[model samples]
Target chain A: MSETNPPIKIELVSDPMYLCGARELVSCIAHRIGFDDMECSKIALAVDEAMCNVIRHGYERATDKPIWVTITPLSESDESFGGIEIVIEDEAKQIEPTAIKGRELEDIRPGGLGVHIIREVMDSVVFEKRETVGMRLTMQKRADRPEEAPRISSRSSCPIPAERRVS
Target chain B: MRERPIAARAGGFPLSNDNFIDIEHPESGVCVVIPRHDVDMSRSPILRSAIKDEMGSGLSKMIVDLGDVQYMDSSGLATLVEAMRGAKNANVSLYLASMNAKVRAIFEIAKLDAFFSIVDSRDEALSA
Candidate 1:
């Protein structure tokens, strides 16, 4: 009965603080869509980095300009791969997808690390410079155990292993 | 104009070292000195105190020098955002000075370029 449902989408305005807000937003939305805790953290980190890049380089030092982030979660039937998908769009500046290179944290240079972090955390990261407007960033995450639907946090209430029976 | 060195406490780090954070309020109200590298979650606590201490002294205008910062993560950006908010609440105006393209990039990504005043040099911030 649930196989024909569409994706869930969310939109938010971009701000300097949005970097942090993006992380929180992804964590909540991903959990609501059934992603585990670790998966949610990874998505949040990726979104944070990508939005940071849009806020920085693409916008050309302008913040008043509008930057939009849209998130859509792909349902299980369509994504047998067992994960979630999110898309972020900004009408600020444009980024050259070809020019983006992920940086090694060990290398630690300044200019270009955000894109690298985004790629590192997300299963699939796609960047497209819209014809004349801004840019679109797409990210996907795959769940290892969709059935279990692992709890986001693992701190169980009762500190009882199977061996410690009530009897 | 006397220059005083203030180590970044809780609200500062990565952008300025504990030993290198400096404040120069010659004609300008306040100036913040930043270091070259290694700013992340662990060092943010230091920044808070540095800014708070400066503001406590009644300095209204500020310049944050970031000539040396090579890398800054979300934690680093958070510290700055908090400081910006703190400064505003205290009626103090803050400006970022001498940001490297990399560090400056974080500001742009965070959309902070719209909220704070930034300049090419400390002198620029001081004069403004």
Candidate 2:
């Protein structure tokens, strides 16, 4: 929330093996933020998918490339509701943010469900291609606490915008 | 990096001493795989390759035991879907057994719970 309370940051190679560590880190953060078991698991899963996309699509499985993750706790004023924000940064070939789409569920197959899963679990997903190189993916989820209900944004109520949704 | 038999392809890439997965042949034509870690992008490849090898060997009935798997992401789900496709092509019956609560939730969220044959235990899966 402030400079003194910096977000948790983790840097790892683009290798898939680090994905497990990433998942564990996010899961711990989600639990510390008061998310329930189910919510924590979903958050962890969403974060994992986002990282996978960066490693596989953005970095093209180049294990030497670096991937950075930052998890910040958000206050109510940051958005209509208070929750957590996960930022994934990768220095790889830039991809069009709008072009990212997951495969249709009806067409059952492998390798395309990452985007869809992230979209489903998170309250909002935003993609931005960095100026010179790399891409940044930000996924936010509203805390499901009763006290946070009144300030919840109408936008946050919808998990994913239909336009950007894959499934 | 090291070459190992399908039996040793557990845990994930780089194959740690932790044994992330285990394989068993309960009966002829039946193979059971138990994953001991979270099935994400890092571990899905191991699962895919193992199932592919089983399909190649003409195994007709495959059961995946997810009782020990506490987490699974889309990549893991995609691996299962790919395995399903391979099984269909080989005329093999692929079943999922003992999915924990967290793993089951993901399948339900993706609406894949209806797509796969899910059972409470390996015995039920084998019987199904």
Candidate 3:
């Protein structure tokens, strides 16, 4: 609200199936804002991971619970610091972030890797647990990776008719 | 209606002849030659089980040749890592050969390229 050109728009939903849709929307937003493929992939993966946690870990198949997701563009100052801000909130359960530590490959059991993947892919991951409420997770990612290319598909070869080529 | 989990094969094991070819060697053990396309999350579970079944058949040394694989994702990487870990836990050896740049990028991103031994050819994966 403080002097940013167009205040970033927000989309809120409480449906589980919207999870996949949300990922696509983030990718579209990233593209509109000029984020590279790797950055877009990172955001998509982060969304999948977080939503998986909320669905599997927090609600445990209880579809009656609701999850909150907020997307906001960082202010000029925040952009200077790096990336967009994504916040996901859930009032289903209050769980400590530390409880979701990465297990060694030996202990690669099903259902525990989601939270670990979320923290690893995102640049900064913060988890807050409120009393008698749920947990909020905040994440940041750089809109651009210096080492990554612009993501033009390398296979540029296309078949052309000889008659068309002559023109 | 609930979306059925992706079924890799119909009334058969996960290793479809379309995606993998089984090869066996006396000295090096059994190897599965991965095909060129469709090596994504949908097939990872089947790939993992195929590797496990091969290991269970007393083929300690295993090789996965990704010479033709053009794309891979995190779940694919996770499957490969799990296969490698499974081999180690079972006291067997595992190797990969001819990883393409796009598929290899996933390994690099997952920081697993350094953890696994990769070679250029099937023979190399078998012998080394």
Per-residue CA lDDT of candidate 2, range B59-91, in tens?
Answer: 879899998887888878889988888888888
By lDDT, the best candidate is 2
Per-residue lDDT tens digits for candidate 3, residues A136-165, read 888776544443312222254322322225
TM-score of each: 0.50, 0.84, 0.59
Task: Give Cα distance to truth, residue A42, candidate 1, Å.
Answer: 2.0
Better of 1 and 2 by DockQ: 2
- Chain A TM-scores for all candidates read 0.73, 0.81, 0.71
Weakest ten-residue segment in model 2 chain A by summed lDDT: A154-163
**Model 3 lDDT tens row, B18-107:** 444333453644655454443543355566666666676566677787776644545566777778888888877788888865456555
Candidate 1 CAPRI category? incorrect
Backbone clash numbers for all candidates listed:
23, 2, 0
lDDT of predicted model 2 = 0.77
Alpha-carbon lDDT, every model:
0.61, 0.77, 0.59
Give the residue spans of candidate 2 off by over 4 A.
A1-4, A77-81, A147-167, B1-12, B56-58
For model 1 the TM-score comes to 0.50
Top candidate, metric DockQ: 2
DockQ per model, Cα: 0.04, 0.63, 0.12
